[model samples]
Structures are given as C-alpha cells and as structure tokens.
Target chain A: MSLKNILSEKKDELLASWFDRILDTYPVETAKFLKNQKDRFANPVGQAIHKGIGDIFQELLQNGDIEKVSGFLDSIIRVRAVQEFSASQAVAFIFFLKSVIRDGLADISLTPELYDELATLESQIDSLALIAFDIFMQCREKLYDIKANEMKNMTYRLLQRANMVTEIKDAEKETNFIAIHKKEVNS
Target chain B: MAKLPKPEELLQINYNPPPTEDWMDRPVELKQGNFCWGAKGKNLAAVEFPNARDWTPVEADWKLPKDWEGTVLEAMADRLSKYRSFKVFMDICVRCGACADKCHFFIGGGDPKNMPVLRAELMRSVYRKYFTTAGKYLGKLAGARELDLNVLKEWWYYFYQCTECRRCSVFCPYGIDTAEITLMAREFTNLLGLNTDWISGPVANCYMKGNHLGLEPHAIMNSIEGMIDDIETITGIRINPSFNRKGAEILFVTPSGDLFADPGTFTAMGYMMLFHELGIDYTWSTYASEGGNFGFFTSNEMAKRLNAKIYAEAKRLGVKYIIGGECGHMWRVLNQYMDTWNGPADFMEVPKSPITGTVFDNAASTKMIHVTEFTADLIKNNKIKLDPSRNDDLVITYHDSCNTARGMGLLEEPRYIINSVCNKFHEMPDNTIRERTFCCGSGTGLNASENMEIRMRGGYPRANAVKFVRDKHGVNMLANICAIDRATLSASMDYWVPGVRVTGVHELVANALIMTGEKERETNLRGEPLPGKGGNE
Candidate 1:
C-alpha cells in the first residue's frame, strides 16, 4: 500500500494528538475556554483552528497541491501569529505533524520505497513552513499597522487641535507621511 | 508603604504580591501613570466643582488646602446620608469572591486588585476606617485603615481601571453595583481636583461650547457638510439636513464623536439616510451636540449640570420631543439620571415615532427614546423598506453595549434591528453577551493610547468572545450602539481579533436601506462594493 494511504487511514489519531499539543501551549485557564467551547459563535477562533487542522491533514495526504496546502496553513498561522506566541513558537506547530506521523507509524517496518515516500511527506511540511513564515510575517505586519494607525490618529487629532494639520492637502499629507513612516518604522 | 517610584519607572509592570497579611492589611505600593493628570483648577473652577486646581497626579504632594481630609470625609458622610444606595453599598459586603473573576481586568492581567471585589474594597476599607465605630477605634483589626497617600493612589488606579459597565453587579448575590462604587470613588477624587486630561479637557470644552471635542458652530456644519457630500456621492441625493431649526418636531442630539471619526461617522450617515427618507422634522443642535456626558464620569453634580443642556436645547428648539442618536452612556444618563436631574420636561410632549405612530410609553417620563428603539419600531411596522441582501458581504454579530444592555434593558431592540437589516447574524457565547456583556474596556475616559496595555488586558474577555464568533462563523462585523464602543472596539478588535470590523448598528441599517428614487448601487454606505457585484466574491 502507498504511504499516503497509510497516513490517510490514521489521520484521525494524528489530528487528535496535534490538537491536544496546540491547546497545551496556552495557559491552563485560557485552554479551558478554547477546549470546551463547541458553539461556533462562542469560540469561533478555537473552533476555526480545530477544524482547520483536519482540513490541513486531508489536503496534505489527498494531494500535495500548493494552493490547497497554503490555504489551510493560512487559516491556522494567521491566528497563531497574532496570539501571545513568539515567532518561533508560532511556527513550531507546523513541524509537529512530522513527529505525529512518525510516532504513529513506528510499528510498521518501512521498506526503501515507503521510506522515500515518507521523505516526500516530510519535505512537503518543510515547504509549508516557508509559506507559514510569510503568513506569520504578514500577520505581525498587520499588528504593527494597527499600532501605527492608533498613534497616527492620536497625533492627527492633536495636530488638528493645534491648527497645524488644518489644511485639507496637509491633512492628507500628514496621513500619507504617517503611513509611509509606519512602514519604514516597521521594516 | 514603599517609597514613591520615579516617573520613568511608572511603566515597569508588576503584579502586586498575593495578599499575605489579613484582609485589613495596607495595600501595596503604586507606580505612577496609573492615575490621570489632575483636573485643571481653572477648568474645575469654571464648572464650579470644588477644589479644582493644577496639580500633576505624579507629584508627591497635592498642595491640598487646610482641612482637606476633613472636607473629603465630610463629603462622603454627606453623600451617605443623602443616598441610601451609596450607604448600603458601602456597608454590606460579606467578601464573597463572586465578583472577583467577573472583572475583565482580573481575568486578562491576573491582578488581584483588578478584581471587582478588591477594587470595591479600596473604598470599603476607607469607609470602615472613618464611618464604623469598630473601625474608628480598633482600625486595623476591623479591616480599616486611615486614608493615607497609598490608599488614595490605589483608589485612583483601580477606579479608573473599572469601565463602570456594571458586569459585576450581574454576578453579585448582594446586587452590589460596582459602577455606583466606581462613580462614587471618582466623585471623591474630584474633591482634590484629581482628573485626567482626556476627561477634564472635554469637560471644559463641553461646558463652554456645547460639545466635548470643543467643536465650534461652523466646524459642526463643516463636518456635517462633508457627510452630506459622501451621501450625495453614494445616492446622488443632496438632501440638506437642518440645524437649530425652531419648531422642528424633534431635536436630534448625538455624540460629536460621530461627526469626527470613521465608524461613528458611518453610523451618523445611517441616521441621516433614515431620517431623510421619512422626511422627519428634526433639527440637529450644535449647541447641545454632545450626547455622551463625560461629567457623569466625574461627579453627580457635574453630570446633572452637563445633562441639563439636553432638555434646555429641546425647549429652545421648540421641538415636541427628542430623538437621541446611537450612543451608550448618553441613554444611561437620559433614562436613569436625566429625568431626575432636569425634568418635568413638561413643555415637551411624550415621544411618539412619527413614521409608525408607536408612542414610546416607556420613555414618557424621560421624553426621549433611543434611536434603536425608534428604528426597531419602524422595522416592525414595515414603515422602512429594507434590502437585507445589501448586507450579504457581512456575517455580523451584535455587541451589547454595557449601559444599553444592563442599565436600560435595551437588549432586544438592537438585535431586532440587526436581524431585520442583515441576512447573516450570529450571537457570541451566551455568557459573553446581552445582560452579561463585557465592556469595550475603554469606556469612562480610559480610551487613551498611553493606557493601551491595561486596555488590552481589560478588553481580553470581550475580544476572546469575538474571536470565537470570528473563527466559527467567519464573522467580520461587530455592530454596537455606543460611539465609544465604535472607537475603542476598533482598537480592541484590531489587537485581539483582527479582520473583524467594528461598526455602529445604524451603519448596518443604512447599508441595508433601499431608498426611494435612488440609482441602482454597486456599493454599500462605506463605498465597499455590494456583495457578489464587485470585488468581495
């Protein structure tokens, strides 16, 4: 049987392990809310992350389509990049899949051909981490954007009060300069 | 108490050590920046609030007048005598921890003082020290301490930390309303001219000019004209809205934040479109432009004094009734405090929706109705035409503004309006919404950026709930009635639940509204394209 078939068959067990691992990263108190909440409206982010994991596994096993793999990775990474994790910690979950599969399949002896297929599966995840790094960077960039926007709004309002940014074009200039300076500041 | 820290050390974060000493033990040291800049003596004196002066909160000494402690104690005693509610709240806590976990601050930051029980204890400890016989004589054992600088600093930090959303009251078995306690604490702080620039600046501006932004008459017109131009761009209709027009049937008063900001301005646009469609005889008042009273955050007398202008403006405009725009605390002041403070309102008739003729008997005493209540009635009567499909791009959830939901029991009206106008609607976790709704965390004038860290921690519970819905339902829009919510939740949503758009309920209404004799549209009100018609698909 193909290695894809072997992994696809045990997808449920692998996913449960991955989900449990991710939940363990949060503080115990926060984990309770994220775990027990079943209603989508009540725990949307938790539920989204939970559902995205299974979709991610199926897409990887069923087909290694770059678009499909990136789509699933985007859903998971966008949230983690935003959460309290550092950059390395946020991307750590992506690599966990390799261990889950390796640990789950240990009993079966792999011939050279199957071992080669498993190597292919490992490389797929390696490719996924690069996409995830880009997505994570994008998320952090958006966060800095929000902080920048807040500072600009505060300054703009103050400048309005001071009669410095009163002219229409200058108001536009202040907004533009702040936006450009924000990118420079972030970079 | 520890020695005062330098000003630069103020931002260094530390959670106070767990309570090692008895409940009566003196509180921990306070860092600077927890308290706001003192109310400008000039601004306080202008508004006639006692002891208003220019003193920084960071300074070691306040330069209090002789007998200042006596003045504070006497003021508390006097307030206790007058308000049975105040006295009862001060006297009756069994130290049940029911309200501790309920505070957003406690949950987010893990600070014990942020717990509502502990936050309220700052006052209760002082009350025991001065008022009770046991506390007066056997102070420390009686869980009391003399009012000292440390206790005062603690009060300023925790009281301002509270958004006064009254979520704690919902959980308390004694029905101890923490908002009352928070307001009272701030009222006492006013005795020393202690206030923040974010607050006193607005109070001074509102006292002289009719709005908090210190907006002048021409400036108000200029801002509204800009809205009119946007309305013209979207609908090809340049309908002129009137200001200060005497004999207009209703006087419309909304928070000036709506005139100045993005999401609030969008909601203001919603009001204009709806009112213009009905041809309602309403006049906007630059003189009474503000609806949210910051003075309510200060003291009862100041709240009353600021609120007095709403009725005064209604009388001046010769309007039969008032129609308030989408605002949060404005209605709290209107429903609970306004009638008591400035009414017979005898000159103005009870408000009845002109379009649907639904006499709002609930507001007969106050003579003003919330805009959501007004809009809900119109939707129920089919007086307004709606195209819910225009909101197809949005999978929306309604955030119950704490004052509107708990203070006024205005839960159903906003939800009913949202349901009628939007095809996609979702409720957040039951515990996190409606009467149990969490605060936007920046209410009561703590919305400044310098305080963003505390604001985010305080906002976590609300954002956590939003993330739940955003993930589960692909929810993008969070609609609320409060102007402060519109501004502050924008920050909160961006921080914790990015990609979720915060909007006013009226903005959703305007987006779904299909006007008579209007051209076919490719976009909703913010000029975002109609779903499936343009880019969103």
Candidate 2:
C-alpha cells in the first residue's frame, strides 16, 4: 500500500498522536487549557492548531501541493509568532510530525523498495521546516515594524509640541526628524 | 548548559517570574517610550491646575515648588474627605493578590509593578507613610515609603500605564476599585503640574474650542459633510443634519474623534442616518461637541470644568434631554461622576426616546442616555428595518469597552444592537469579555503612539483573546462602542492579530440600515465591496 493510503486510513490515530506532542511542549497547566478545551472561542489558538496540523498532514500525504501546504502552515504559524515560543519551539512541531508518522507505521517493516519512498517523504518534511522559518522571519519583521511605528509617533507628537517639526499642513510632516533636530541645534 | 542570561534578559517576561522577596523591594524603573511628556504649563494654566509650568518626568528633581509634599498631602486629604470611595480604597486592600493576574499589563508585560495591587500600593504606600498609625511606626515592613520624587515618578509611569479600565475591581473581594485610587493619585499630581501632554493637550483644546481636537464650527461642518458624501455614495440618500439649532428637543454629543476619523466616522454616519430616517428633533452641538472628558484623567475639577459645557449648552438650547455618542470613560464620567459634580440639571427632563416613547428611567437622574440604548430601543420597537445580509462580509466579534461594561453595566445594549444589524457575531473568551473584560490598554488618554511599548504589552492579553477568535471563527472585524477602542484597538489588533480590523458598533448599524429611497448598495461605508457583490473579507 502507498503512504497516502496508510495516512488516510489511520488519520484519527495520527491526529491524536500529533496533538499530544504539541501539548507536551507547553507548560503543564497551560497545556491543559490548550488540550482539554474543545470550544474554539475558549481555546482558539489550540483548536486552530489541532485542526490545522491535521489538515497539513493530509495535504502532504495526498497531493503535496505547495500552495495548499503553505495555507495550512501559515494559519498555525501566525498564532505561534505572537506567543512565547522561541524560534526552535515554534517550528519544532513541523519536525515532530515525522516522528508521529514513524511511530504510527512502526508495525510495518520498510523493505528496500519502501525505504526509498519513505526517505523521499522525510526530505519533503525538512523542506517544510525551511518554509516555516520564512514565515517566522516575516512575523517578527511585522512585530518590529509596529514597535517602530509607535516609537516614531511618540516622538513626533513631542516634536510637534516643541515646534521642532517645520512641516506645513500640505508639506511633508517629517524631513527625517534629524534635519529638524539639526535646525533646532543651529537656532 | 543553563548559564546566566544577559542583562537584557531581565527586560523580557520571565514565563514564570519568581515571587521571592517583598514586591516593594523591586523598584520600578521608568522605561523610555513607555511614558508621556509632562503637561505643558500653558495647557495646565488654561484650566488653573496649581503650579502649571514646564516639567519633565525623566528629570530627577522635577522642578517642584517649595512645600510640594504639603500640597499633595492636603489635596489627598481634601479628596479623601470629599469622596469616601477614595478614603476607603486607601485604607483597605489586604494584598490578597486576587487582582494580580487580573491586570492586562501584568499578564502581558510580566512586571510585578503592573499588578493592580502594586499599582495601587504606589499610592497606598504614601497613605501608610503619612495617614496611618502602623505605617508611621513600621515603615518598610508596613509597605510605607517616603513620598519622594522616585515614588512620584513611579506613580506617574504606572498609573498612566493603567487605562482605568477597572478590570481589577471585579476580582477584588472587597470591590476596592483601583480606578478610585488612580483618580486621586492623578489629582495630586496635577497640583505639581505632573501630567502628560497626551491628556493635557486635549483638555486645553476641549476647554477652549468646545472639542478635544480643537475643531471649530466650520471644521465640524466640513467633517459631517464628508460623512454625508460617503453616505450618498453607498446608500444614495442625501440627508441634512443640523448643528446647534435652537428649539431642538434633544442635544447630541459625541467624542469628536468620530467626526474626523474612520471606523468612528462610519459610526457617526450610522447616527445621522438613523436620526434622519426617524426625523427626530435632535441637533448636534458644535459648542459641546466633545462627549469624552480628558480632564477626567487629570483631576475631578478639570473633568467637571470640561463636562459642564454639555449640560450648559443643552440648557441654553432648551433641549429636553441628551443622547451621548459611543465613548468609554465618557459614560463612566456621565453615569457615575457627572451628576455628582455638574448636576441638578433640573432644566432637562428624563430622556424619552421620541421614536418609541420609551422613558429612559435608568438615566432619569442624569437626563443623558447612551446612543446604544437609544438605537436598541428603536430596533426593539421595530421603528427601523435592518438588512443583516449587508454585513455578511463581516465575521464580527464584540469587544466590551472597559468602562461601558463595568462602569455603567451597559453589557447587553451594544450587543443587542450588533446582533440586530450583523448576520454573524462571535464573542471573545469568557474571561476576556463582559465585566471581566481586558482593557484596550490605551484608555484614560494613553492612546498616544509615543507610549506604544507599554500600550502593546498592556494590550497583549486583550489582543491574545482577539487572536483566538480570529483564528477560530475567522473573525475579521472587532466592534466596540468606545472611541478610544476604535482608535487604539486598531494598533493592538495590527500587532497581535494582523488581519483582524477594528470598527464601531454603529458602523455596522449604518451598513445594515436600508434607508427610504436609498439605492441598492454594492459597497460598504469604506467603499469596500458588499458581500455578494464580490467583497474580499
């Protein structure tokens, strides 16, 4: 039987195993909130991840479409980006799927022919991890951009009160703020 | 392999920050980008706050006048006597730590000082030092400290960080409101001209121009005209809304932010449409254009000074009652503080909805009703028809603005209005909403972008909850009543949940209202497509 057939039939077991591994990464008390709760409203991040990972597994085993894979991956990764997860911890779940699949397929021995097919699948999982790194970088960049925007506004308002910003209503408000500071120094 | 962390490590949240020594031992250091510039002397002088001169929060000496401590203590004693709630709150607080985790700042930033108990203790410590028997003798053991400049700076930093959302009071067994303590602390600070530009600037503008943004009569007209153009685009209805018209039965007041900005402006359009459709005899007041009282953040006196205009203008215009627009602390001041300070508004009668003839007995004392209550009354009586499908593009969730939910118990009215207009509505987690709601983190005039760090950190818990709904139900729009929420939650939502957009409850109302002789709509108020007409939510 093909790998897709095995994954499709034992979908329930794989989902259950994958869910537990993700829960194990969180604090014991917090994990319960992320695990035991079923309502999406009560445990939204947990629920999205529980269903999201399952969707990722099915796409990988069935079609292996990069566009569809990124969609599921992006949904789950976005939550982790804002959470307290370190870079390694955030994307480690993607790598954990390989073990979940292996443990589920433990009963069947991989002969030479089967070994080649499974090894190729393992390589694809590594590529998915690299794609996750890109998403993580993008999220962190957005976070810093927001922080920078806030910092800019805080000082800009202060400068406005100080009469340091020389921009007229229709003119550019900030000529790199540095130029205004220099003008203040010269004056 | 678990070596010592770098110096910067302490700045980061410690997942489980250890609770070892007394919390008093850990001093609060004011971080840059987490504080507001001191109130301008001219701004403070405009309203006669004592010693309204130039000062800097970051400076060590703070340029206090002689006998500054005496002034603060006397003000505190005066306030304590005048408002028993402040006195009782100062004396009580057994430090049960029930309110520790309840604070959004503590949960988000992991600062022990951000704990509502500690934030209050900053003031309570001074109370113990001067006002109590044990603290006078026991000192550090009793959590008492000298009311020095460091203590003053700590109060300024952390108290401003507090949005005055009052989330902590819900968890306190004694219902010792931290907001009561914050108001008193802020009042004492005003004696020294120790206030933020973010707050004092608006207070000055509102005091002089009759609006917070200093919008004159012509400017207010230009803004309303802009909204009318947008309404014409979407609904094809040209409606005339009068300003400061005498003999109008009701005077309408709203936060001026609604006229100049979006989400809020759309909600403003909803009010104009709803009123024009009913053809009520209500006129907008350019003179009392501001519903939000920023002076409420500084002191009770300044707040009263700003709030007097609303009733003053109402009385002058001979309006029977008042309808206030969507605002958070505006309601808190109106519901709890206004009548006590500025009333016996005996000239005005208890507000009765002209459309439904429903007597707003709840507001009988104040004669001012929230716009949500007004709209909900109209909808309940079938006075207006709403097409919920027009809002099909929105997968909406209601954020309970901290003051509206807790201060006035206006929990159901906004939701009732939202449900009547929008097809889909999801709620945030139980703990994050209703009276237990987290703050938008920028209330009490902390919405200035300068203090975004603490705002983001304080906003984290609320944004985390929003992120939950956005992920689960594909909630794209967060609806709230307060103008501060509409302005500040947009930033928090962008940072934490990038896709989720912030909007006002009435914006959805305007979108769903099918006006008489209005054309079929293909776009929303933002000029975005309507759901079936190929909108990309």
Candidate 3:
C-alpha cells in the first residue's frame, strides 16, 4: 500500500494520540475535566482545541494551503495566547504531531519512497509551527494593543469632561480657510 | 545544528506537570501580569487601615507588621465567631469537584489553583490547620498546613485573583459561597494593609471626596454640564438638572464611572434624557456622589462608612427616595449589604413612579429602586415612546454583570429595557447568561492595567460566549448595566473579539428615546451616526 493510504487509514488513531498529548500539557485534574466535558459552551477551550485538531489534520492530509491551515490554528492559538503558556510552550503543541505520525505508522514497510514522503510530511508540520508562531505573535500584539487602549479609553471621557483635551487645528485647513475668506472679501 | 532527539525521546518533554508531586507542594509563584500593584501607604492611611505601610507582592520581604500571623489568626478567629456564614463556609466544603470547572479562570487558563474549590482550600487549609482539632494533630493527612509566610503570600495572590463573582457557589452542592470566602480573605489581607491600589485609591477617594474619581462639587457639575451640552446638541432640549437641591422627590446616585468614562458617560446621558422625557423630580448629590462602593472590596467597616453618605445625603436633600443608575456591584450592595450595614432608612419612603403611579414595594425597606426597574415599569405602563429603529446599527447582546446576576437577582429588568429600546437583541448561551453568567472578570477592583494578562485570562470565558453570539447573531454591541462592564468589557472585547463594542444598557435607551420638541437626531448619544443617518455607512 502507498504511504499516504497507510497514513490516512491510521489518521483517527494518530489524531487521538496527538490530541491527548496536547491535553497532557495541562494539569492532570484540568486535563481530565477537559476530556470529560462535552458541551461547547461549558468547555470552550477543550471544544476549540478538539475541533481545531480535527480540522487541522484534515487540512494536512489534503495538502491544503498554509492560509487555510492558519484559520484552524487560530481557533486553538487564541485560547492558548491568553492561557498560562509562554510563546515557545504555546507553539510546542504543533511539534507533537511529528512524533505521533512517526510512532503511529511504525508497522508499515520501510520503503525509500515512504521515508521521503514522511520527511515531506514532517517538513509540512515544521512550516506549520512557523505559521503558528506568527499567529501567536499577532494574538499577543492584539492583547498589548487592547491593554494600551484601555488605559487611554478609561481616562478619555474624563479628560473630555474636564476639558483637558484640546482640538489641534489642521494647518492645511487653516490656510485653505484663510484663502477662501480672503478671496470672498476681495471679490 | 546540534543533533535532534529521536521521536521517542522527543516525546519526553517536561512541559507536562509532573504527576509525582502533589499540587500542595508546588510553591506559589507571584508572576508578573498576574497580580496588581500593592496599595500605597498614603491611600491606606487615608482610610486608616491597620498596619498601613508600603508593600509589594513580588518582593521577598512584604514588610509585614511584627507578629502578622498572630494578627491574622486573631482576626480570623474573631470573624469565625462574628459571621455564621463564614464559619459554615469554612467548615462545609465537601470537595465534590462540582465547582472545579465552573470558575472562569480555571476554564480559560487551566491553572489548577484557579479552581473554585481549590482556591477556597487555599484559605480553608489554613483554617483547618489552626482551627480544627484533626488538622492540628494530623497536619498533611488532614489537608492542612502551617500558616507560614509562603502560605500568607499564596493567600494574597489567590484571594485577589478571585473577582468574587460566585459562579462556583451556584454549582456547589453544599451552597458554599466561595465569594464570601474571598471577601473574608480580603478582609484579613486589608487588616495587614495588603490591598490593591486600584481598590484602595477608590476607597480613599470615596471616603474623602464622596466619589471614586475624587471629583469635587464643582467638578461634578462641570462633568454633568458637558453631558447636558451634548444632550442639547443631540435632542435640542436642554435638561435643567439639579445638584444638592432640596425637595426633589428622588435622589439619583450612580457610580462615578458614568460621569467620568466614555460609554458610561453616554449611559449617564441616557438617564438624564429618560428622566427629562418623563419629567421626573430627581436631583444629583455631590455629597453622596458615588453609588458603587469600592470600600466593599476592602472591609465591612469601610463599606459601611462609604455607604452611610447615601442616607445622610437623602436626609439633607429631603428627597422622598433614591434612584440608583446603571451599575453592577452597586446594586449587589444595595440589594444585599446596604440595609444590613446602614439600615432603618426611615427618613425615606418607598419609590412611587409619578408617571404611572407604580409603587416599588420591593424597595420599601431600602427605599432605593434600580433605574431599569423604574424604566421597565414605565415601558410596561406605556408611558414613554422608544423608536427601536434608531438603534438599527447595533445587533445587541446582553452580558449579565456577575454582581447583578449572581449577587442581586437582576436578570430580567435590563432585558425588558433592552427589548423596549433595540430592534435586535440576542442572549448568549443559556449557561453563560442569567445566574450562570461569567464575570467581565475585572470586578471587585482588579481592573487595573498591570494585571491585564490575568484579566484577559479571567475574561476569556465571557469573551468566548460573546464570540459565540457574534458569530451566530452578528452581535456588534455588548449592552450591560454595570459601569465597570462598560469600562473593562471594552478592552476585553477589543482583545478577544475585535469589532464588538461595549455599552451601558441606558445608552441604548437614550439612542432610541424620542422626546417632545426634539430635533432629528443625526447621531446616537455616542455621537456615532445612527444607521441610515450618516451618509458614509
């Protein structure tokens, strides 16, 4: 059988292992709760991660574009971005799939072409990790932007109320207005 | 590059928490972005808090008072005797894990310590060690430990992390209110002068100047004067509002946030426009300027001290009753704690709506009615006309502020008002609304900028629900009655679900309110052009 066929057959088993590894990063108690809870509204993080993993796996199998894959990654990364994970730790879950794919497909016959195909799949995941890092940084930057804007917004109305803010006149508008007024008077 | 590990070896990363060591032995790490700045000595001294001094949580030495442990234990013992609820809560948790996943912090961040049962156990452990006979002898076996400095620091970090939203208490089989435990823990911390600057500064301001923003009498007028001008520009009807005027039938008190912030300012305008449309006899007081009490976050004594001004001002102004504006914890205090702390408000009478002759017998004892209840009554009586089409630009969703939903049972009044004023309204998932509502996550004065990361963590569940509605209903505006929700949820929405704006419920009312002798309003109270009004959209 072809390497793609063998890997596709083991997809469900591999995906479950990869998902379990991702949950393993959380505390044992929290991991158990995340596994047991089924409701999306009640367990949002777990639901996102589970749904994201399945979609991401399908995209990988279809050799989907990185842009399509990123949408899946965002669903998971957005939750992890605010969680207690450093940037490295946050993106590290993507790397677990590499080992899971290799370990799950161990029983297949070792053809040279299969080795090349496996390496290509591994490279795809490596590139995915890079995309995830970018997504993670975008989420982090958005958080910082929100924080700075909050400080400004909290005092904005108060400053306006106190008359602490003054409108800075546009110099170009001033010159145009002066020209228009002077012409009108001369005419 | 160095040689990479084999696949089997690579899977053995220590990123997973070790299973061997128990969570109890994991030393507390006071991470940056997880905690707020400590209360300044001057701010604490302004309120005359015991052991007033400068302190920071990150520092090795907290500069605690000599024999601080003895002080805390004595205070705990005293409180154990004083509040029967405290004693029962300390004793009654069965740890059925019912509340473990319910906490927003735990659900979002996955920090085991954020679990409500475990968070309570941080205090319950100390309570067990010092107070219970089994814990005193058995120690670790009985789930108790010594109240050392590490334990004290853990208490400081975890107690403040709680917003006291009481979502966990809903799931607890024993009816254990974990928020009261957090309140008790905070009260103990305040005894050691350990308080957050976000909370202590407001407490000091409220104590000295009668408002959280420290706006003096003239400044309050100045701010309201700005709103009055905006009201005139929008409606072409200048509202002549009274300040500290005697013989006004109702005294209006709201959180100073409404007078000082963007969306909250708009809500304040809504109140004025609504009152003017109905032509109610109401007055604002500079003496009791703030409705939300930050002192409630500090200690019971301080909360009582801050709450006393409202009744005193009512007597001074000779208003028959009080009408509180849109706020969250303020209503919680009014509904639960106000009458107990400073009661027998015999000077005031039950609020009766002059427009519809509806008597608020529910507020007969407190003599203070919520603005939503009053407005909902008016709408039910068909006394006011609201053009819901004016709010066509907004696909609105209601976020029940934790204090209002869980603290006070204020679920339907705001919804009734929202339905009366807006064309589009959608409720978030059933579990995430009403009594099971998640906090805006920055309540009880944890909304400081330094703790933005943790605030976002705590806010994740709430933002998740909003994201659900935004995806399902194209929800663009998050309407709430809480002032802090107006302030903090804006940042949270900006972070978690961009393009979603936050507003006070009354802001929507003001946008849809049609007043007699008013010009065509090209813009809403926010000065943003209404849908089909501004040409650009």
Top lDDT hit: 3
Instruction: Report the Cα lDDT for residue A164, model 2.
Output: 64
Interface RMSD of predicted model 1: 7.1
For every model in order, what is the iRMS?
7.1, 7.1, 1.8
lDDT of 1 by residue, B1-537 (tens): 989988878534221223345444645444432345566777877787777678776677876666767877888998999999999998898888778767776665545577788888888888998999988899878878888767777788789889999998999999999999999999988777777777888888899998898888888887788789888888887778999999999999999899887788899999999999988999999999999899998999999988999999999889999999988888899999999899989999989988888899998988999999999999999998999988999999989999999989999999999999999999998999999998887899887765665676677678888888898999999999999999989988887788999899989998888888777877877888888877788
- Give the distance in Å from residue B534's predicted Cα in candidate 1 to where it truly belongs: 2.8
In what order do the candidates fall by lDDT, top score first?
3, 2, 1
Q: Clash pairs of candidate 3?
A: none
lDDT of 3 by residue, B356-420 (tens): 99999999999999999999999999988889999998999999989888887989999999998
Candidate 2 on B489-527: residue-level lDDT in tens? 888888778899989888898889888998998898888
lDDT of each: 0.82, 0.83, 0.89
Specify the poorest-scoring 10-residue window by lDDT in model 1 chain A.
Answer: A177-186
lDDT of 1 by residue, A74-97 (tens): 767766654445676777777778
Alpha-carbon RMSD, each predicted model: 8.4, 8.0, 4.7
Against the true structure, whose TM-score is highest? 3
- Candidate 3 segments exceeding 4 Å error: A169-187, B1-14, B18-20
